[model samples]
Target: MKSSVIKIALILLGSYLIGCQQRPHADKLQNATTKKIIGYIAGWKGVDTSAVQAEKLTHVNYAFANVIDGMVTEGEGRFDQDKVNIQKLHSLKSRNPDLKILISIGGWTWSKGFSDAVLTDDSRKKFTDSAIAYLIRHDLDGLDFDWEYPGMQGDGNVFRAEDKENFVLMLKSVRQALDSLEKVTGKHYLNTIASAGFKSYLEVNDLGQAQQYLDFINIMTYDFVGPGTDTTAHHTNLFNPNLNGRSAAQAVFDHVEAGVPIEKLVMGMAFYGKSWKSVRPGNNGLYQPAVWNSTHPYRNIQGMVGQDGYVRYWDEDSKAPFLWNQSDSIFLSYEDPESIAAKAEFIKTHNLGGAMFWEYHEDSDDGELLNALFQSLRK
Candidate 1:
């Protein structure tokens, strides 16, 4: 009888422990389905907070706070303006209390000091302390590191091989500091990074270790066909089977292979388009050589489509759209409502974390692209 009683007790204990383990997993699964819509707001563009559609976004990463002399600071000569912009961004919380505003430091231009800032423990602490202080002073929710390209030359920024490890260490220190702050303020803070979409970036850094310290990794999936590229292609295509080129689908796969969890990966979209001049007329100007290239905001691209001899064409394989102007030999690659809906479907099908876009103002005043994202992701 005692043996049977003990056996029953063992079974009950096992069931209790199994239930305990499954509870957290169930919560994680529930949170995973709640997608995030992150938008990068350019503070330099003079953020008109009133115009910002805060209700549609889950997070807004303000670009950018700069790293100066091993410390975090507002951009040089723009401190006053940055302070006002941050204040304005904070006011947006009134519209959507759940909205999270993060300060993104070290953009393409301001990433020069990252190498020296996190070179040693003391420097890392200094940088971390200043970052935490900035957050506290601004009453911000978190920090987003946008180190252009660690261990790689980006916009003539200083870089070293050690940057690969230091980058992880930097994130760890900041995460620890944020945790300590949470203990005092009773509020949780987030830590995220804007990672490059290219595979070369994964080769240099260890995202497997880095993700442990991050809440989300926002990949810049656009700019695949950047300036000086002789061939014109999709800058932010969801898929590209015909040509072996960069695509958002490929980038997400690379990140997953690089050890980033699919639940923490936020797919990036472009709110603007890339334009090339003097392109060959074959394939509706797809994969053709061009002499000059420039950027066009979505607001402007909307007006240009089907006007002034510009014809819009869709590549079914790539799941992308483009504009061809045979008279001007101008080819444009960009995302429209159709492409945005396709990407949103991709995100849902793959169970990705969510979506992020660059520069809020690039979208139309009527919030065309943002509405597509909200309807697809939020609704």
Candidate 2:
């Protein structure tokens, strides 16, 4: 009887330990309290700081720090603008002292060099050294790599099958460099990446292995449906009710299942919308072939909501909003406060890291979407 009882007690203890391993840490809960509201600041565009509510954001990522010859540097003729924007961003510290400013290296257009820059150990170290120096020189908090992809073809970028493994090595090298610098400066510098949202990129890189050397992964959940598609679909839907497998929720699940902790996944939101002309005139003009129209900033979409041949429509299936102009055969897929609120709720429900958006200046002076996120998450 004594032997049987001891075995049962051991089993119970083992079960408890397993459960503890799955539970979230106390720091995760604290971090989620102010859940990061990261916004990308476009350095090339003219910014209006008065329109931004600095207090609502936790971090501001300055977009597109060019990578040249395996080093991070200013784009050609962009030194003046880059310096001014960095200063302007730093000035906002007076309003929100806790705001972290990071320099985002490589974007869709500038990611071509990443393949060669991170190919070998020596090259990766060179890139890491330059990135750290650039951060210190700009008085930035950290660095973000928007590499588009590692082993996939992206916007004319070179790719090799070996990149699948090299990408992991590159991140490990970078994390080490960041750690060394942290020791010297006595400050914690965040290392993050702008990851591809779909499974294509997921299949190439080992996210579980890479997550060890990173802070958080910002999934670019937008552009799932773009001008290149034959049918108009929800570009940034929270849920994919139709089973099309192209929604923010699906991407989150995919990453988590692939071994990335949910606490390190930040759902991406788009501040702009994609419009298409010549859409079929039924079913609210959704999932129909249409001619691609210009990508409209949220500010532009706001004005056209109830005017200019645009009538807003809510999609219950995708849990998103799209504009369908029946008279003009036009359709626009975008996000608003209601949609953003749903995403915030989703984040809390799933215990996600936080939410991030593409660019900041697209929002109105009132910061409608950002306000929705701030209120929803805080509440």
Candidate 3:
């Protein structure tokens, strides 16, 4: 009897460990063997309907992924539930039966809506319940909460100290609802979120409270600085690509130490670059205006080629790469195949949870960069 009890106990313990295997393992997930987690973000309402053309790849991140903030935030910022978005998502799932569609909520604009949603229980419920339905109807493989952050607010909203702990509670509620739905649907739903780039976001908000509950976290590793700044720097580099303190790789390390398990940390890759006017000594840094390109004077840096303007080509030293248009002498921010591939290799060599890119439309229609990512992962 004693022997049998010990055996059962050991098996139970093993299962629990597997459930909690998100940490330390990230450093060893890849070796001369095993597959790494490589995902992409398929966003941009302007993206082609067949965006998931790279479905053959192991995982698709579904970029600049937005959360259903409802019709209220729809005007200017309101998201329309067009049949096209739903059809495309389903098509991606059907094409690659094994493909994972993670609905990323919140982005450069979506975050503003979150500030108001979290303040009241009724409102939070309205958002949460609607979200649960969104996940179900959409048949998402998981949910990625890109809340920009709680306890702190940007875009006209004020941050409340209580939001620190409330973020965890919010995650807990989401997790429970997801798991419950899983029981009936007989499917395993994933739960991930995008973490703030700054350390203070975690410290003051105590993300440690929610870390354990999340299946993974994508650290927005880019945007250290851009056109709006008085200095230029690499937006996404494996290490000190531009010889700067802020690089995509460093952000990954920062989150790991913040109690966010390494396995649960997914590095955010920017497929786009930041641009500024003229390469003068005072011009550098990522500008917010890039996401809203229409209102900005800087044209699509990647789209213009053979043109006498913009800096094009990868900066091998920075490992990130960028382009500078000549005509307007405007600086554009973006990441190329070579740069993202290098970072993906870093992710593999370091044994990280693969990598994630910013959005879809930023990449060339040729899908050259996404092709590079698939090739790197295959090797």
Candidate 4:
């Protein structure tokens, strides 16, 4: 009887240990929270957004699902997309009740309203109020301010003195609103922003103040360089003195030094490739005519064109992707899955917030990039 009793006690102790090990850590996401952050972005949910596929990938924690129309300056809005996205998001609640679906407003092209809206309290109120309504309508868990920048323009924007202070104020106001809603609903909501790549990207902004409001910030780390009117180096890569600025590993360091909490920073990855063509073949210098091409059709040295009448191709040496052609000799650079995995590891090494991607479609459907990221960086 004594021996049997001792064995039972041991068994109970072992079970307790196992349970303790399973407990969530400070940084380790709760099963539900983890599922919400490991999200994907398809186009708009109103369209065929592969919502089912996303659900299949339900282990993903956060879904910054589509609802652009709702944030629009006019007309139907992302509200048109809200019902469908929310329904889809609701389906995931059964499996991941804590999973968060954020409405990411603004994009490479959709940032025009941001500058105008944030310039005044009334417009800011209009934008934020509409945003809250949209979130309420669709049952979203948070909002991602993806404004390209307060003052940046196409080649990417330079910072302004006003942007430094006003930006933090804007974030604080949004956070206050979200917190108010949280108080009433007892539902957790996230406040976040998507920033740019320059080492001094947010130089004009106050990260310390911003961090107080933001849950975290997603740094748009890719597209460091792209073809526009000229060949340029952009995107993450081993530095070559021969190339240009846009994309460089150093940019990551830049943000960290700027006082952004490394723990609250999620390195953004790119799954696509930028292409370019050499004006002087075999010279390995100068590319032109940038095209948005992903699958490199020819060898790294070779090139192809799309219906848009622009040629595209890749560069192997940089370990970065790009597009270029003879006419324009424009060089574009981007990141692929392999580089993305490396970035994920970088995030892990720094113990940063984790990782985020620009959009879901840019990734090759195998989930290789994000999966590798999950494996490398998951807490």
Candidate 5:
């Protein structure tokens, strides 16, 4: 009878252990299906690796690698530092094994070489070869092309009518190259792009064709209002009742209409705010005329809020937040925890892929905005 009791006890203990193991594995699988939170780390500013909360992020895009003379290379004079930064970013995997690190190539100033680089079959091949080589060298998980505008003169980039078609071709070439690499390594390499947020950019390129080659299309939904626009408005508002104005909702709708799958679209949030000075106080500075002021990181803006005569205001129609200094005639547009929470709800309701922010360092040292995003999205 004692021997029989021992056998039963062993079986019960074994079952308990197995159940414990399966629970965590099941939880992990569930987390995998949750929305992605992609953060763009500005390597140009030099990454403070220790500050990055890798657990909160699904992916980190290092901005940027540059295109020079039909080859993918490090930014001008940034090779040594970028290597170190990338290495540190790789080390972050110890904290979150599922984290992905990617190299973002081409930005507003570095995009000038794209037109010439992809102008011909041979040129496209060369660019593709260089991109793959760079990916291998850096031990990166993916590549993100931030080519600015494909067929337009972005920061005086060399553009042609052919860019509309060539843009798709370039993505196709990169996708094929990644597939080839996958065959040998048996590891999937992601291909993504930092797409422009406005309608004009979509009018020029065939994103429908482009999406087939991409894993995710991160729409730059911020910066609707910036320099050269002497107007005060929300730069990263989630909605705009005025159909003519720009908003995150409008951008997402346009992308769907442009043929990009809703499942693969990731909306962007700003960690920084746009400031305008010398503003007319009409309507509390919303949609009023003012001289464009310098941009401020959310951390700095946090200190200015409710201080220095800055009073925070919420726009119900747009589901955004702003700061107004009626005494000083200054206005600031930005994203806060409340606004980010609203965006998270929007993401869930729309069944969108996830949320992506322009940069990592702009948030508070304690990661207030990122925390809000992670909690809201994950919950």
Candidate 6:
């Protein structure tokens, strides 16, 4: 009888321990050893989606659905063109059933309208209604708001101090609308935002409130150093050892610390490179005074590698690569297979959501950068 009582007690204790065990958090979810791989397909790029290697991606966001006077415009002026492109994106599901296409609205060029759209309850309703109708009409799986910013006019958008709270109110309204439609259709719709990586941007908006409504926030980690800057540095470095400026890791921590769940943040990688000309030769033309030159798509850069006096060098501290053409006094900073792999490792190490790039057209036909991300994340 004593032995049987001891066995029963042990069983009860084991049951209690099992019941107390915690489930995995969203960020730490064990999703087949790889997180979601999202890629942006810029609408104006005129990319032929049929040529896209759809199976490599889990989600493709259609770029730049214009917002006009508080109304969501499916396309800026080329409505038919957008329809055709969206159709092509949806058709990719035949090849990869898991692929989801989302409509991204209010990019840098078109974000001006967002200020007025979310200003009032009535305006928010109009915008929310337009968004849902647009998604349903296009048969899209989700919506991504890429308003360059809220409560800021730097992107040629109107601003108000109230934008901070208004932004959250707008997102909540949209989420509620989407949920209502979902209940009727018995389908899920994802709602996300393309957020700025800078800490200043995070402070202006209520990300904690916004996060509750968003499926995830896509952090634009690239472009930290662009043509407007005076000095040269890695615009998308994973870690800033020297602390010259913003790093991807810093941006991730800022957002997560600001109340966004780690799993709800998707880091953005640039598929193109930012370049500078007339760079001083000191420090191998890095962090030197230089004039910002035009950006080079990875496809174009791939062709320039090891040619035209161009030589690529890797920075061990930043975990990024740069190209210097000593003959032309040109310096280029961008992501490559190695830097991208490092970023993938950062994502895995931090247990954050997977990687995303600017657009599919910027990559080589061989899909070099995309392949690197997919392979690295899989491991």
lDDT value, residue 81 of candidate 3 = 42
TM-score for all models, in order of appearance: 0.91, 0.91, 0.75, 0.69, 0.91, 0.91
Q: Which one is best on lDDT?
A: 5
lDDT digits (tens) for residues 218-336 of candidate 3: 78787766535654455566667333367667777777777776767767776666555544422332222232121121125445644664446555656866555545545555666
- Candidate 2 lDDT tens digits, 94-146: 99999999999999988888889888888988988898889988988888989
Q: List pairs with backbone clashes in candidate 2.
A: none
lDDT (Cα atoms) of all candidates against the true structure: 0.91, 0.87, 0.62, 0.56, 0.92, 0.87
Worst 10 residues of 6 by lDDT: 23-32
> What lDDT tens digits, residue by residue, belong to model 6 across residues 106-140?
88888888888999999999999999988988999
Error of 6 at 20 (Å): 16
Report residue 352 deviation for candidate 6 (angstroms). 0.7
lDDT of 4: 0.56
lDDT of 1 by residue, 303-334 (tens): 99899999999999999999999999999999
Error of 4 at 234 (Å): 5.2
- Candidate 1 residues lying further than 4 Å off, grouped into runs, are 1-33
The better candidate by lDDT, 2 or 6, is 6
Score candidate 3 by lDDT: 0.62
Question: Every model's Cα RMSD, please?
Answer: 5.3, 3.5, 8.0, 9.4, 9.4, 4.4
